[model samples]
Target chain A: MALKAPLAYETKHHLSYYECDATGHPSLSMLISMAVQVSEEHGNSLGLDTAAIQSYGGGWVITSYEGSFAAQQPINGEEVILGTRAIANNRFFALREFWIQSADRQVEYVRLTGLFVYMNLQTRHLMSIPQAVIEPYHGPEKKRLPRLAKARELKDVRFKNDYHVRFFDIDSNRHVNNARYFDWMQDPLGAEFLTHHQLKHMTMRYEKEVRYGQTVTSEISSPYRNENGELTTDHRIVVDGQLAAASTMIWYE
Target chain B: MALKAPLAYETKHHLSYYECDATGHPSLSMLISMAVQVSEEHGNSLGLDTAAIQSYGGGWVITSYEGSFAAQQPINGEEVILGTRAIANNRFFALREFWIQSADRQVEYVRLTGLFVYMNLQTRHLMSIPQAVIEPYHGPEKKRLPRLAKARELKDVRFKNDYHVRFFDIDSNRHVNNARYFDWMQDPLGAEFLTHHQLKHMTMRYEKEVRYGQTVTSEISSPYRNENGELTTDHRIVVDGQLAAASTMIWYE
Candidate 1:
């Protein structure tokens, strides 16, 4: 018998000029968008696409994310292979793993883990994953999966800036696109640090949904560029003066 | 014997949920992005993609746009075909036509025309189209091209709203994303009227480029709902109180 490869859904994506940022690298938001796209494709390949889940009056709602980026990232004009696989799941929670790697080179750009929960689309209440929906994946059950580091509690933030959520920020979900939060979080770091440093890893937790016409205030605690040479920061997003989201980012030296 | 395509190109795009607005349809900005995508794919097929054009020290710059919409637009989760073809060109001007239609039905969703000017990317000066850039396209020459109606001149503007351009609005071009102009123009109309009306047609002239951190004001003349049951309005985007862009819009009853 011939050797078989591990079961994982794959897609090839060519980076367009517009998908890049001033730095000629894919923006954080674009990275998330690509992840979402591959996940959708994976679901469809497994016969558990949006339509399949919707048949049960529910949908998969992402609850949190953890991403680890290689020191080098893919640049514009690069074609990358994006691979994703369902990792494991409990009754209410499903875990998936994703990676972006160079198609022609031995470079892995990033690795990602996403936590999603099944929810009733109408009532927005958490629900158990249907067997028919999960069966096609062949994902392991009760397998120990990668865990996300807990973000430091944010308080007494010193720097603050407000961003008015524009019409473009809202997606078909009638809420701000989750990736937009990275922009809000990073903008507070200003152009100096953002241009100088590259993100090594990040953990973001989406707490509340932001709507259009709302102003999100982003606050950051003064960074601790420690002796070990790693820079760490805590960030929070406040909407209408209420906490909407939070994250912690660690940057490579 | 065989026939050939009329120097036209097309690509099918599945409208993802994130591409849509709260109204469950693709947003105006996303529609424009799709147009840009198909246009790029068309150029790639013709061997005149961004890399190819930049190699000649030049690129195509959009000078203006005119868009017409069908009352019914494609909804989220639908696949639509985007088609574009070069209509005609002079030395400095190339006019192109585009249309968005349903994949399964005989319904046309929107039609657009874009006027482009060849320019030196470094100097931003007008240049003649290179033969290499135009050869593969096989677009006809001197055929009468579609024209956008000239926008009515603006006088003293009374009603106006100011918007501060956020950092995210800046794209790889180092300028405000052109689609941001539509949001700035429509927001001044307020939510109630925007929710009920649909844009029938619009002619927008890109007079000046807006930059990040700049504040621009959107001014609109009082709209007139005519005897034909159509609503017409004139809009101007003024940056630093100088006319940056202008447009005329007609809405379906």
Candidate 2:
């Protein structure tokens, strides 16, 4: 039997100019910020504030995400509705979905899918989703969590350099913006290399979530052969040698 | 002698909601977005593109500014310092000042004292400030820009309400964050009483600047010795207007 997904809390956020990307629309990192916000509110509505969860010696972490962008995102100052729902739960994993809509027409702007894992804060080891956490969501035990897009495999995934997390990297919500990962993931490649190549397609899979005051050391390495006999690259954002996010980018010459 | 003030080309901007006030920030009627930005990057030292500045009109317009604040007022990531120079023309007043900072510190921040005036777009009523806009800064021309602030004579003042502008009320340049003025100046009064107050002291002066979108506003009005025995309740930001910011709280309860 499938457990009934809980209707998580929803919030309305007004887009700010600082949230927009060079495309004149909200950047992908901003969407993740909204998702993270709604998820926190969802937990709060369930009486699971981070402090309380930490008290239990367990904390929530994002394991992976498979999100989709429907169209150009909202512009600054536009009110957008953010909705999050608890979709599924298992011994070690929980699934959530996020939706963003414009205030005027309630038209969808972006939809996101995320996977969360419970972990021991002290040990940084994965923990089973406690029965108490799952019971509140009214979810069932029989349904399996959906699979994420597998990170592209490469023969020469080289570990490049490390990045230090700065205070400005944290937002009002206290976590780094998701899009910032792209910066860290790309920075090691050198500014000249980045300027010379354009990202044609990129698929990022988040394996874990890093929090404030945590210096996430990223390891990026990409090596691949394209159909046209050209070299390609796959990247990884790792925190202390653990994979946090992975991406495969098709570059423009 | 005022050293030659920075000479920069004019630029443009578009206003966003985050730049607006819930109560008194820029009102709907005064929603000209790009003008302030043009002034901030007037010289375009940060490498702004021409294609971006050509929107709305060939020129940017700043209608008026009411107040000022100290350092720590600017918002995060805001591009500033372009519009800090004044033009030679009196009608196209170029009110400009830069943020003061101590030595040996990296120039991470600056405050721009901006002066603006209104002009007709179609007719170019005031027209553009020509080469002489640089005159005042070269040396005090014995010319005085209109004062934005003067101490109110408390005895004869009759204030219907107090005024306030919050920390968030100021912008990145820190001068009473311009966005806050809309809500600060207008929100204290009511729809029924809009016509009663002829603003003579709209000039707000800066002492210590508010930082990063803090909720603040100004408290103002002519003083009155009322029936409550020296009772002076000009105006307060009541929830329904009950002293939200910069309110005058009497201890005499």
Q: Tell me the spans in candidate 2 whose CA falls farther than 4 Å from its real position.
A: A1-5, A104-107, A154-163, A171-179, A186-203, A206-233, A238-244, A249-253, B1-253
lDDT of 1 by residue, B147-223 (tens): 78766665546557788776656666555678778878877776556667778888888887787778899998788
TM-score of structure candidate 2: 0.48
C-alpha RMSD (angstroms) for model 2: 17.0
Q: Which ten residues in a row have the lowest lDDT in candidate 2 chain A?
A: A165-174
Q: Which candidate number maximizes DockQ? A: 1
Docking class of 2: incorrect
The window of 10 residues in a row where model 2 chain B has the poorest summed lDDT is B23-32
How far does residue A94 in candidate 2 sit from its true spot (Å)?
A: 0.6
Instruction: State TM-scores per candidate.
Output: 0.84, 0.48
Instruction: Extract clashing residue pairs from model 1.
Output: none
